[model samples]
Target: MITIVPVETKKQRAAFIDFPHDLYANDPNYVPELFLGQEDLLNPNKHPFYKHSSAQPFLAYKDGELVGRVAAIYNTNHNAFNKVNEGQFGFFDCINDQEVADKLLQTAEEWVKAKGANNIVGPINLTTNDTCGLLVEGFERPPMAMMPYNFPYYLDLISHAGFAKKVDLRAYLVNKAGANQRSVLLLDKLEARLERSGIKLRQINLKDFKSEAEKIKKVYNKAWDKNLGFVPMTDEEFYYVAKDLKMIVDPKYCIVAEKDNEVIGFALGIPNINEILINIKRGRLLPTGIFKLLFGKKNIRSIRVLMLGVLDNYRKLGIEACLYGRIIKNAMPSGILEAECSWMLDHNYLMNHAIEQINADLYKRYRLYEKAI
Candidate 1:
């Protein structure tokens, strides 16, 4: 028999966060998320996401043993912005058992249905602005920072549960040895042309991070407004994320396009911290884990070009190529050998083509699933 329990207390929440660690113990590719980070994300009071939305986590137990977990989310901001009645499920993990998976999903579906959602979509992990999608291809390696990963069987589990793919997200890998260097070579010329139009590209100023982040936030919202499932992040939400990234952000990898003192485009690349976090047992950052994080950063050899965007009006101005070129050029001296440019919507032809032009290989794919409630 199977039983599902809502995570209402501190103990249950802890168990819910820790379940994935145990389930993936034997999988060498599994990287545990930081315990405190996950704790804060699930905390209503701590995460800015909860200020405009609500979620309930459920843990599944089979014969008194923990087996799975999922979060039923009602994102008011998403619905209001997109004008759709959709609830989401996220933070999902489960054993390979079909029954357990079905029960866990059913619980989430019902909970969202009660909240008046006409359709359900996810593995969204709180929102589209956060880590999302189920790994449908490329399970050979661990995931990059801020990207999602799952067992290959998850595709079948979700399909059997009456979910179908809403869209596929792409992850491209660019190796220094294999990548074309034309972008780097032409970077100077590209910037000169952009400068003629009063747009200058430069690294983000750490000293002016607060004001810089505010400017970038506007560009981010505007640049990505037309994306599927996009909802503009509130100030609190943007700052909360910016604060966390600040610690790991390298100036060279955080490039901005400025015109008339306004930021119109930017690209952010973060060291693949998962390389270090994978070694931190259970994602605990204490006792010895903190040392691993601090010292291991220097040894990181790859970065994830996780975000790169330009305002719609600035498209096709070579700003995107310049951003990618600048990052690659700066990375060469830093001993960075490869980078992952990830989670691009498969249908985003212009962006996908831009990445491919630089010889990035489409190495991984993730899918979002949807079903009527």
Candidate 2:
């Protein structure tokens, strides 16, 4: 017999976070999420998302053994911004059994329905800004930082639950050996043309990071507004994420475009920390894991261009190509083997074209699903 329970206690939440570690112990492609990070993400008081919306996590047990888990989310901000009453399910993990997947997902659906949601969409871990989607393709290696990994059977399991494709997100892989360097070759000329127009590209100043972050946060909220499911992040939420990412930021990959010293465009690439986290036992950071994470930076050979955006008034100035070029050029000399410019909306032609110009291979694809309640 199987039963579903809400995660209300600290121990249950710990189990909710740890279940994937045990389930994926033998899977080489699985990387453990940092324990503290996941804890804070689920905590209302710690994460600013709770300031605007709410979420509830559930665990499925069969004969008293943990079998699966999922979170039912009611994103008030998303609903208000998108003008749709849809709930989300995220942080989903389950065994191979159809029964387990069905029960876990069903629990999420019912929970959301009770919250007055008329539709449901997910495997978004929290929001589209976080780890969203089920890995429908590209399972050859471990996931890059902040991307997700899952069994291929997840495709069928989710479909079996009456969910259908909402949209597919793409990840492009660019290797140093395979990338077209024309962008780098032309960067000087591009800069000169932009310089004539008062736009300049430069590395982010770590010394003034707080101020820089404040400027970029505004650009971030406005830049992606037209994209599907985008909701402007609250000031506190942006600050919360910026604070966490500050520790792992590499100046070389965090580039900005300025018009007379005012930031109007920016690009952020993070070292693929999953390479290190993959080796950290169960994502714990005490006793030994912290040492591995601290010392593993030099060994990482890949990066993820997780975000690249230009203000509406600044889009056509070739700044986007220059940002991608600068990051690619910087990565080549750093012994970086590969980079992924990822999670682009399938229909985002302008951004996709920019990535394609640099010869990035279309490697991985992920999907978000939705169903009417």
Candidate 3:
């Protein structure tokens, strides 16, 4: 008999987090997530999301053998920000069995219903700000930094369980050989023109990262305010995230737009550390995994332009192109051969256009699914 078990004890929760290691043991494209990072996210006492919402991790068992896992989330912040009574399922992993998938989804559905959610949505590991979405395309290569990956059968499994597409997110690839450098070539002239209007584009000041991060947080909260399911992160949340990213953030790949010393726009490209994480056995950074992460930095050959945004008033000013251009230009000489400008809203025309104009290929697609309960 198949049964769904609530993850309660520390051992059970560790099993829940480590289940993917076993499920994808043979999949070459599967990159293990850092165990400590995953643990921190699932730990409410450590993650700030728990300050307002709650979640539960579950495991599926078939005759005593673990078969699948999922997390049912009651994101009070998401509901309040979106004005919807919906719940989310995340950190989902399972075998090819439709029955197991059904049981897992049902478990989440029931858990969320108890919390008053009328509809369900996700694959969002935590929030939209974090790694979320089901990979529906571009399976030829391993995922870029912070992106999710899954088997093709996952689509069928979720669909068979009644989930339908809510929206599609896109990933674009830019290679040094095929990238359009017109933006980079004209960056000087563009900055000159913007300077006439009191705007300047420059690299982030790592020496004053704390203050710079605070300014960028304001620009970030405002720039993406109209995006789907976006919420203004609290001060603690932003600082917490900033502290983590600071460790790997490269000033060359981090840029900002300033108007009379006020940050109005910013873009950050983090090195694709998956190159090293893939070799970290089961994502555990111990015994030797920590050495790989620390010593393998320079061997990384790609970057993920994970974030790029400009204030509403700064739109259409060619600032976006310049930001993209600068990152591309900076990467060419740094031994980084490629970068992915990703997780774009499919309908975000202006931003999508900026990417396309620079000749970024839409290489991958990830989907979010929803079903009314």
Candidate achieving the largest lDDT: 1
When sorted by TM-score, best at the front, the candidate numbers are 1, 3, 2
TM-score of model 2 vs. true structure: 0.98
1-373 per-residue lDDT for model 2 (tens digits):
9999999999999999999998898999999999999999998878999988999999999999998999999999999999999999999898888998998898899989999999999998888889999999999988899999999988999999999999999999999888998888998999899999999999998889899999999899989999888899998888888888899999999999999778899999999999899888989999899899899999989999999999999887899999999999899999899999988999999999999999999899999999999
Candidate 3: clashing residue pairs, number: 0
Give lDDT per model, in order.
0.94, 0.93, 0.93
- Please, what are the lDDT tens digits per residue for candidate 3 over residues 96-168? 9999999999999999999999999999888888899999999999998899999999999999999999999
Backbone clash pairs for candidate 3 read: none
**Ranking by lDDT, best first?**
1, 3, 2
Over 4 Å off in model 1, which ranges?
A: none
Question: In candidate 2, which residue pairs clash?
Answer: none
Report the C-alpha lDDT of model 1 over 21-76, residue by residue, as the tens digit. Answer: 99999999999999999999999989999999999999999999999999999999
Return the TM-score for each candidate structure. 0.99, 0.98, 0.99
What residue runs in model 3 are displaced by over 4 Å at the alpha carbon? none
